[model samples]
Target: MEATQQGADVFFVLMGAILVFAMHAGFAFLEVGTVRHKNQVNALVKIIVDFAISTLAYFFVGYSVAYGVDFLVSAAVLDGSAEGSPFAKQGFDLVKFFFLLTFAAAIPAIISGGIAERAKFWSQAMATAVIVGLIYPFYEGIVWGGNFGLQDWLSESYGAAFNDFAGSIVVHAVGGWIALGAVVLLGQRKGRYTSDGRVVGVPPSSIPWLALGSWLLCVGWFGFNVMSAQSVEGVSGLVAMNSLLAMVGGILVALIVGKNDPGFIHNGALAGLVAVCAGSNVMHPIGSLLVGGAAGAIFVIFFNLCQNRWRIDDVLGVWPLHGLCGLWGGIACGIFGQEALGGLGGVAFMSQLIGSLAGAAYALAGGFAVYGALKLLVGIRLTPEEEAQGADLSIHKIGANPESEMAPR
Candidate 1:
């Protein structure tokens, strides 16, 4: 039974890992569809390479920082070969690392959208290594790994521990806030803002691609949330239901608030999924719906606010979509997860509030520290000449469809 359980758990998590890993394609396509034709190649390259760099960083350093577990020991110990036979024990820890690595990798993926046009490729990759290996896992350790008694303190003081079933604040919020720092440093994409103060619109290159990306993410999210249970026995149908309701709510609200803009509609679905990540296991499906609706609306409102009002020029509005919605998800868990509000009810408003704030705060500091250091040391942005040339030709030496362009026009 022990051997069976261990192998079963490995299979379950490995499936989840594969599903969530596929979401990286969702990230790539979403960015490809959002950025202009001139920069499409950069978008595709960044997501894949960032994932690669994130894997290396997470495997070597980030996992240890977060969980205090190192694979430096003999393979027998790492694979639990001593417990049962090698096959029976399974390489479960390796697959668990794969699953968590996808989540950590998303921090750079989120930032990639915000700094799409202007960031230097190698600079960002270096930043990715630092973030995945160090900055992000530090907080991951605190919240999920229980490194410094933060969860214990929250539980003792407020009658509940801070709860994030997945990576709302841990992954999404941190990614968003960190993107804010990078975006602010990188500044607006050239010609994105005119000297006289009018906002210049740089429209999406491909709506069809964008829609496809959204669909991929929506499908993969079932694994992202439900498989967060990590064991078949721990899985809950409520999580699947809540994710569906939240996504539905996000789509509807975005359709209404965004005046049927396909961009908003696709992103609205993401908003809902982001918001539902924290509380999907505990919140009632109805509460999840409201949370999703709120997140969709928040994405539309703050995306506009960041671009037009704040002049942040976050290309894909990642800060609002992932950052703000993530923070909301964290706090909303406290609100909607209470028995009074129809959640399973071992959560506290104070703990959630504080935990959410702390996560965002730490992210901002880490972002500024990492990106700021890089800015001073190596420069994070493309030169104006490079920016005007577009990242495709400037960085990658080719456009996305060079053959057709070269042959005809």
Candidate 2:
């Protein structure tokens, strides 16, 4: 029986790993579509760099902090295993590791989106190291890492805890906050805003890429959401069915609001997935659909507001789609996600509000502290000359045409 249980754990780990691994293709396509063609190569390079840096960092130290060197403690939480057991035996299942890696990889995609077109590639690369290597893992330990640290305290004290099943707060919000900080430090992209502060439109060269990216993300989102439960036992076939329903809800909302606009429809699919991520393992099928539809509607309204009102240059719509919708998911979990799914009995809606604010604040503060320091020391933004020259050519020295300094503005 013991041997059988161990085998099951291994199977879970491998399956989750495969699911998370598939997310990379999603990230690649999504990011590729978001950036202008002038900077397409640059976008691809950043994702590659993020993956490399996150993997090494997670293996060397992050794995310890998150899974814990006191591997027994985490293991005990999982299966009543002894504390201080063999590191190899107690660590995150291969599936969990793969899932976490995908989470780590997702962070830099958000960063790349915010800083697209004008960022110095080296600066972006350096930021990627800081985020995955240090920032994310530390917080991840507190949130999802076993042994129940801060998040557990909040969960118990408030209601069910700071319940983020798939990381509306853990991954998406962290990425969004870092993206926010990077943008603040890097400043707006050239031609994004006029001297008088009017916003300008920079149409993408290929909507096809964006569409492809969105579709891939929709598929990978299954892994991103369902894998959070950590087992087929915790996440059953019903949960998977709910996820499908949620996607349908999001699509329906997008169609109504988008009213024949293909771009909005594509983006709506991603918005739905991000919206459902927080409570995919917990919410009812109907609940999931409502949450997803709300996210799609919110994405359209709020994103336009961010563009027109705030003039924040989030090139890939990360702020509204991921940041705002991820927050919605957190709060949704508090309401619709029940104790059985991971919530506290009689979960107070207010507790969810507190968690959402707290997560956002933590992310914002960390991002400001880290990226702000980097900006002051090394200078985060590129020179005007470099901005005019496409980042691919200016920073990387490779582009579609070596002689072409910049992609046409």
The C-alpha local distance difference test score for the whole of candidate 2 amounts to: 0.72
Evaluated with TM-score, which candidate comes out highest? 1
Candidate 2 residue 172 Cα shift, in angstroms, is 1.0
- lDDT minimum window of 10 residues, candidate 1: 80-89
lDDT of 2 at 108: 78
Scored by CA lDDT, what does every candidate get?
Answer: 0.94, 0.72
lDDT of 2 at 267: 77
Off by over 4 Å in 1: 83-88, 407-409
How many residue pairs of model 1 clash at the backbone?
Answer: 0
- Summarize candidate 2's per-residue lDDT along 1-409 as a digit string, tens digits: 7556656665776676677667666666666776666677777787777788878777666767776642224545544355644533433454466667778778877677777877766666677777777788877777777445665666677755666677887888778777777777667788888889678887776778778877777777776776666765576665576678777877789888878566677878777777777777667778888888988887787767766788777777777777788788778877777766443335556666776777677777777777787787777777888778777777677874555655676
Name model 2 segments beyond 4 Å from true: 1-5, 70-85, 88-95, 146-148, 338-347, 400-409
